[model samples]
Structure formats: C-alpha cells, structure tokens
Target: MHTNLSSLNAAIAGKTEAEALAVLADLFPGEVVFSTSLGYEDQVITDLIYLNNINVKVFTLDTGRLFNETYLTLQKTNNRYDTKIQVYYPQTAAVEQLVSEKGPLSFYDSLENRKECCFIRKVEPLNRALKGAKIWVTGIRAEQSGNRQDMPQLEWDEAHQLFKFHPILHWSFDKVKEYVKVNNVPYNPLHDRGFVSIGCGPCTRAIREGEDFRAGRWWWEDESKKECGLHAK
Candidate 1:
C-alpha cells in the first residue's frame, strides 16, 4: 500500500541515505529493488547502495538501443562493485512486431508511431521488471521536468500499485554531479558530451546550451509527448 508523501517524508526526515537504506532494509526486510539507467542520478543512488552495502537489487532495462557509453558504464559498474546488475530486455515478439510494422524509424512519422515504439521497447519491459515488488526506487528529481516538479520524495505509485521512493528528489543536477564526482561513481560518458536525458539511440540526441533538459529525447516530437509512458500517470 502507498503511504502519504508527507507522512513518509516525516518518517525519513533528517536521515542520511545510509540511514534511509537501513530503514528500508528493515521495512521491506527482503528483496527491495532499485532500477537504474546509468544516468548521473542513478549512478549516485547506485553508489549509495553499494557503499552502504545495502541488500537492494539493482537492475536496468537494456532497450537494445542504448548508447555504447551506457553499455560500457554498465560493464564498469559491474566490474567495480563486484555485484550483479540485472539487465531486462523487451519481449522478442513485441519488439519484432513493432519494428516489422514500423520499420524501426517510424517515430519520424507521428506521435502515435513514436509512442508505439516506446510502448514495445520500454514501457512493457518496465512493467515486467516491476512486478511483485513492494517498493520501486528511482532516480527521479523534481527539477528534471515540469510534470515532476510537484513530485514528492516518496509517494505511492498509483499507476504501479506500489510505494515509490525518490531519495534524491530535491537534489539539483549540480548536487548529483558533485556526489558522483566525490564518490567516483561510474556514469554514462554521454553526459559529458551533452546528452542530458539519455534514452534509446535513435530517439536521443545532444541538447544545446539553452535547450530544455529533455529536448534531446524524442527531438522530433512536441514537448508533451516526450515521455515514453514508463513515467506516465
């Protein structure tokens, strides 16, 4: 069951990430999971989990279109932490059907077509990865998007019917970067090259200085259609 954000925040207030992890360790007491995309925020959370020796499971969706740098970071994370990071892939039939019908570049045509691609490649697989989990941990920060600005540090994910926790929800991009640098955590190299929001290869690009943080993702579509449905309400 999802608890109210205020109550959850009060419970975790004044606690460090390590303290929070200890509380989560006792709260769930079994099989807590954290999903990552090898982004800066995710890397910071990954480092916290690793350094604190938290028993939470860390995993990622390998949408089959990730950047080479993302793949390398995944490899490096595994090598450095000496812990297994599970990789989830989309179902073969769903992927084949979308590609076969849309020719893999259908997102260039219309919003519906792009959403169709995202549904098959990301949303569906994420649903599977989250199944049966009591808590869903993410690297979501309020400043990341307008829609996310109102998000709380912890809330019930009514969409997924689980408690959703955002340890760094109030953190700034600079703070996330600082933590990553200070901790020497492994992150995607593309971040340094201007990819603020990384996703699949065809849909993601580098953003300009004045562009929106998410402009690089689905650059062919309007702002409202930027989401891939995983974060949709």
Candidate 2:
C-alpha cells in the first residue's frame, strides 16, 4: 500500500523492457508479479522477463473457459522458457454456486449475469493471484481500447492495492507482432485468425477487418459495457 510513484517512475525512465523489469525487481524484489494472457504483447513481456532472468512471479488465470489455442501457447511458452507459469483457477464452490443457480449460459441473458460470471471466474481469482504483491505488471497497450487510452504506463490501482505497470503501453499492434516474431515468443495462434483480443472461449470471436481491437470480445454487449471487471479501475 506504500509506493512512491514518482521515484519508481524515475528509476524506470527511458529504460528498455528488460532494464525496467530489473528495476522493478530491485524495487519490489519477490513482490513483483506479472499476469499473462498468452497474447502477443504478453509474450513479449514474458520473453523480457525470462531472457533477462528478472525475478518476477508470472501467473495466468484459467477461467475454465479458454480456447484450445491459448492452452497450446501456454505449453509452448513453458517449453520455450523452461519455466512453469503459475496457474490460478477460480474457486470451485463459487463457480458451482453460480452455475447451479443461474445455469451455464446465463451470461448471455443480461449484463448483470455476465458480470457475475466474470466476477466468479476472473476477478475473484485475480484478487487471489495479486495478494501480497507490490507490483502488478500487465501487457495493456493504449491502442487496444478506448478506455485504456488515458491510462499511464505506471499507476496506482486502488482496488487491488498495488502499483500496476504496463511495459508496452505505447506499442502498436505491428510492433508487438514484430517483437514476437523477432524474439520467437510463443503466442496464441488465434491472433493470426483475426482474434485480436482473446479471452473466454464462449465470449470471444474473430473480428472482421477495420474493426476495433476489442470488438471481438463480448460482441453481444454494447461497446461501452465490454469490460469484464478484471481491468476496470
């Protein structure tokens, strides 16, 4: 709950991804953590952490509703990096209660139901993953969504009680793909099939060309209500 954003920002100022991660490791030590979705940008950060040997705990949420390709990429990444990225699963009791009470496809019925499902499967587990961490690193890029455009590269997340860092906040989609290709980072194959932002298997779809990056996610909902509460400030 104690972070001097200015001093930490100055420490990482003008540093490469590896250097910035090293700085965070020095600042927070074993308390630094990163959550990866096995996407293009996350893969780049994974490479930076593993290749540079940064002491950061990496984890991913298994929502019990993910694409096969995502799992494949997760395995490939583990193989490539020779590391076992920790996996956090939703609490079984909560998931059982939700499904038993509302049925399996209740999320498609209304926004409230969708949010509840997301809370059970993602937000709650994310809170558990972030517990006792001083730094919560992510691969959020500003160009990915309108809501994220105004977010700083590093900022305090009051809800999570941690300093959130976006290492490639200013990177473009092409640049992310370039880094992945050049570094040989393992990424979800769904990206090549037009799935710009991959998420739950039932909730995500491929977007047509000229569409917003987030359009593929929660496509049934209005654009303003697309967030799943995991990234909601």
C-alpha lDDT of all candidate models, in order: 0.84, 0.92
TM-score of each: 0.94, 0.97
Clashing pairs in 1: none
- Quote the positional error of residue 120 for candidate 1 in Å: 1.1
Instruction: Name the top lDDT candidate.
Output: 2
lDDT of 2 by residue, 1-233 (tens): 22698988988999987899899888788999999999889999999999999999999999999999999999999999999999999999999999999999999999999999999999999999999999999999998887788999999898988899999999999999999998778889999899999999999999998998889988999988998888873
Cα lDDT for residue 156, candidate 2: 89
Q: Measured by TM-score, how close is model 1 to the native structure?
A: 0.94
Q: Per-residue lDDT tens digits of candidate 1, residues 1-233?
A: 22456655676789987677656656675647798999998999999888888878888999988889999999999999998898899899988888887787898899889888888888888888888877788889888898888886767788888788789888999999998888888889999999988889999999999998889998987788788888753
Cα deviation of 20 in candidate 1 (Å)?
A: 1.4
In candidate 1, stretches whose alpha carbon ends up further than 4 angstroms from where it belongs are: 1-7
